[model samples]
Target chain A: MNRRLIQWIAVALGAAIVLHVAIVWAIPRVIMSVAMKRIGGEGSVNAFMHTPRTTHEFRAVVRPSPDLAYSICVLDLSDGPVVIEVPASDPYTSLALYSAITDNYFVRNNRQDGGLAEGETIRIVVAAPGAMPADVPEGYEAVTAPTEKGLALVRRVIENDEAMPRLDALRKFSVCARAS
Target chain B: MNRYLYWASALVAGAALAAVSIAWAMTALQGEYRSGPWYTSAVFGSVDADMYTRARVAMFGLLALDRRETMYYTAATDSEGNALSGDCTYRIEGGDLAAHWWSITAYDAASFLIENEQRVYSFSQTTTEREPDGSFVIRVSADPQEKNWLPVKRGESFDMTARFYNPEASIYADPSAAVLPVIVKEGCK
Candidate 1:
């Protein structure tokens, strides 16, 4: 090829690499921003929004499992720390924390650590990196979040239709609030 | 003027190429592990996930847990390597899974549940009926089946996702060795 054409080819190749990296790096953050806004809805930051069972009509999230009931907390640690409390239930239950970049940093399930007994609760304090408070209260496990803004999701398995009412009641008791 | 025109054309072509290539990569590239028609990635929701994996998961799974908490396997083809179509019927057979809870859900090309009159989108371990040997069979088709029927829209393509919650260590070590369901195409209209 001619020298001028070679120069053009090199310019195009450089542009392609730059654009590729920029898009790839931005996808997760952009998608998570949209998701946090949609999931957070009218609820204030660090508060739980108990969603109904997943079904065909549910469009907030892709690949939602119809068998599980979801309660979402859009965490914003800009103030300080957030507290997540999951009530004990008979069915399978789990609390998962995701960073703003969409990485699941921490997960605690009902079956883990010999499982939570009835009337017990899983309490977690989520704080920004290097912002953990000294007074986390008793029985509350503290975790450092990778980002100031993140998400905490609770999933409760719905065994059957008849169990929906009871399970829904139990899941409603779950709490997400700003740590005082 | 000629130099300016050349640079502008070259830059536009480069950006266009990037967009097309990224779209192709997201759709064509499956995860790192493959078993029959299903595939999964060990770093799905891990902090170690690369940019491409994170981008793909953002588009497809969004907020997925790591493999230890939940293993997600997806299949868009049959055992014979044919694309799963709503025009066709498939028989999905499997035995027990190594997770505390498991379910198989169907999603459209956009990864949303397939709409149907029955409002049924998945068959879980707690819901599926098993044979005397404890093995189970599920039917995937537009038409209704007497038992274990997963619906799809006619003339559209779909995919199936099998989620294993709290999977055993054996599955995490070797996902390909896990006893995932077999998707065999039965017939087509």
Candidate 2:
């Protein structure tokens, strides 16, 4: 009630308000934003974001329910269009994409035998029902040609030190176009 | 002097109250403490659960009681079914507890449910056929078909996990101490 006492009380209240605002509101928001940005900004990569690493194996999978059988084959051709037979499907569908389930990136490291180096181009023709999803690595050309039943996927891999093994392995697997 | 004493008393009271309030706020903020293999399989990596990656921490295992415990087991695999950096051995043992439900299941690297004809992954008190002694045996191996078997496939990387819900106080107090089942390798075919 005294004038001096009232002024002192007012000053103390103002100081407390300032401290609370600085510590609770401003500080936590700023810290959280920085942390979130660091976790999610450019150059940040989760396991899903990286190119899928695969081993040498012809993988085939059928979903738990009777739907379609998904199979992957890796093959290499010496010097011709690889011959493939399409399987018949009951209620026809399309070929989705050729990608590693993990990173969804094309398996690189394809090459022709007999010491063929980089800058050598190979042509491929795929025949199927719908669009064939092709995932070529960076700086490569992979085009899909549509077929009556499915889609044709064709891609050329230029092998250097990095892509030699993967590309060569992929060239070995020529997925036989088939329907289920 | 009286005024100074009054002001000091008020300040002391405020400090005490603030300390107690801060303690209360912290306790409130630490909401709903839980332990064990809590999984929300709805999300990728089941990220919503507390995935303990700390060194020296024991990863929780789970069992599905619907199947024979002997029919379910796994070889360790990477998150992607790719090979992990190392090889580890594990087993499952059962224990007597006051809980209403419990079981263990095995998963492969892909995390997609493993395929088996019977669809039994592990045994629980509810589903397992008990012995006369009230004890049970569940097999963990690549070939668990002899009886009470859990199957492990060759070149297949997998994980064995167990889950116990509505557990009695004794089991909750010492889960690791519970009589977990034995893990055996029938041999690689």
Candidate 3:
């Protein structure tokens, strides 16, 4: 009877550990999936969608940056490489990519020195490994995304209340599109 | 029959425990690794992070760069260690922080930006009006004040997060030495 009791206790303890781990692992993925779908709609496609500007009240996402004029694109690399471009942004501008499952693929912000080109206009290509076009011009940057579907967001800091109109003009003209 | 009943009950209890513990861990992880009112972790947004830390950050929001490139600090309480309420007026005062750029932003209990008229959600290094010594104090409350005012509502509790992008190397070497703002509660309704 003692042996049987020990076995039952051990089995229960083991089961708890496994279930605990699975739930922890799955929470982020579930939240990210719901977020991506809500923002980009269903399926994989790349379009430069703009976040609302000239507002301080936070929306659904926790910890949204109040300083940035955000532009997002749903990156679906299965269609081909996506090309992203920004107007001459201050040192605060950054481009970040998150996989559909919440893995960070790449981030290139104005802060980096040599890895990125310095100037008013910034351009980069997002493609799977070994998929970069050979004919692309020199000085163009490349970011290898590990997954076929991802989120690419651009942050343009609104330095002050007066800077909004200029930022809006810049973001409205920014491009996130499939490379020909 | 006794042995079978015991085994079944154990399995059911184990599953229940798993669900409860997992939920608690995720919700409470934000409160760890604190310095004063700021809750932060040195390992955030790094590819080299362990599995559990990565999961916690991802549950909030994932970052492509590591903390060296950008660090995040969140505050939910005041200097006196009281929870920040929308009804209270407070002052966020500090000297020059050791970072290239920084901003303090506000969010309500649900993590959404608080609704206000001035349309001010954050005060950054550049926009905040400063004193003669270059130090600054920002007024935070439902009513508007003179300079560097960050408005909140009257009935909601708020969480403020401060972002330090490209922080000085000294911060990574010894986080204790960093200069942080103090949230002093003035009064409340």
Find the candidate with the highest DockQ and give its number: 1
Q: Per-residue alpha-carbon lDDT of model 2 for B1-189, expressed as tens digits?
A: 587775665555555554454344333432122212221111111112231211001111111111111111223432223332213323333454344344555555644345566555445455555667876656555544545665545466766544433344554444333344444332344
Q: TM-scores, in order shown?
A: 0.96, 0.29, 0.88
Q: What value does the interface RMSD of model 3 take?
A: 2.6
Q: In candidate 3, what are the lDDT values of residues B10-111, reduced to their tens digit?
A: 888789888887777767655445667877777765556555676777666554346676677788899778999999999999976678788898887877
The weakest ten consecutive residues by lDDT in model 2 chain B span B54-63
Off by over 4 Å in 3: A1-7, A42-44, A54-60, A114-119, A133-136, B1-9, B27-33, B63-65
Q: What C-alpha lDDT, on a 0 to 100 scale, does residue B146 get in candidate 2? A: 47
- Give the candidates in order of lDDT, highest first: 1, 3, 2
lDDT for A148 in candidate 3 is: 80
DockQ rank order: 1, 3, 2
| Candidate 1 Cα lDDT to native | 0.89
Which structure is stronger by lDDT: 1 or 2? Answer: 1
Candidate 1 on A1-180: residue-level lDDT in tens? 899889888888888889988998999999999999988876568888888877888888899999988889999999999889998666588899999999899988887888897547899999999999998899999999999998999888887777788877787778898887
Report the lDDT tens digits of candidate 3 across residue range A69-106: 77888888886898888765564778778876566667
